[model samples]
Target: MAIELKEYIVAFIDLLGFSAMVQHDCERPKKEHRYIKVLYTIHLKTKELKKTIIGLEITQFSDSVVLAIPYSQENYKKVVDVISNYQYDLLNDGILCRGGASYGKHFSTEDFLFSNGMIDAYKIESTIALTPRVIISKELIDLVYPASELSKNEHLILESDGLYFINYMKNGNADDSWKAICKAIPDELSENPSIRSKHIWLIDYYNHQFPESKRKDNHRFVSPDA
Candidate 1:
């Protein structure tokens, strides 16, 4: 049989501190269980969401999730929206994820995920996505929007460091959820040094995006070191 290859928008995501969460749950007494249940719930919800979104194909194992969607202008937008919503939902549930999105030819099956797209996505997620955000590859961005049209889009933000990530809270639709995620960041930062460091960019982004008046009365941006 000839192997099939087609263009796709691929996303590679990692559930931050998953091993540590499991370890913490194991070390704690049975009555104090929390992380495992939360992770399981998030996993189930993600699966359900992926099923509802047509054209999306997902494969998950342990703490990693790989999603692929057929490539087209409409499909591209749909994939971006799906990823943004998924990320927000996870954040609302007190779980942070970091990932990367790329576009290229790829192929997958029930037991296999193979593609240059997947490799590129993994590279971006592991390196460019140092914080709790999904970085988009330049190739994908250029394919979706040319240089002249880039600034007109509010859905994506280009960072000073030349990386582009979805602006999930853009346009005020997710104001309440964004605020909640911001407030929860400090507690998440206490998880462990690695997790805390990974979330520092999230904290900084929240501080820059939200004004003091919008912050919870008792909520303050806590340094990861604190």
Candidate 2:
């Protein structure tokens, strides 16, 4: 079969701090830290999500994962949903995700793949998405109704940088995810300032997700309704 170029909303998600985590886990007992299990779960979730969203395409390598969906507001929303769900699920395992998404020409096959869309998405992830968040702007927002969708998306937040990021914790309800972060956050926050900055950004993101009416003046102080 011949490969043809298609416009897609592409997302490139890199697992933040995984390499460091892998090195740290090297000394720990294997039973205590299931790294292989984490990898398997990532692939399994990709399969599950692709099955649900028929047009979604996923390519994963090591700590990086790429998703390309047909260019449409509907598919874009699904892309956001996939990332949000992935963040929530991975958070349970003390994994953090950060990346970028955009729209452009892309194609990927079993034996071969090349995409400007992937490159652009990768650039955004590496540069713009410094924190543990997936940011989007420019082409995608103009091409699709991503900007307009913001008015309706509970999981989307526009930062001072004028880019939109997925507020993955918007749906978090203090379940296992909170427990995982509750431990991981303190450990990470105590690290060197460079490392501490990113985790701090995540903490702020989590605090800002809930509805305005549900929270008090302070970030940590929130009503049960939040």
Candidate topping lDDT: 1
Return the lDDT, model 2, position 204: 64
Report residue 103 deviation for candidate 1 (angstroms). Answer: 1.4
Give the Cα lDDT of each candidate: 0.80, 0.75
TM-score of each: 0.85, 0.83
Candidate 1, residues 94-138, lDDT tens digits: the string is: 788889999888988889777889999999998888888899999
> Which 10 successive residues of model 1 have the least lDDT summed?
211-220
Best by TM-score: 1
| lDDT, candidate 1, at 32 | 89
Worst 10 residues of 2 by lDDT: 211-220
Q: How far is 25's C-alpha from truth in model 2 (Å)?
A: 3.3
Pairs with steric clashes in candidate 2: none
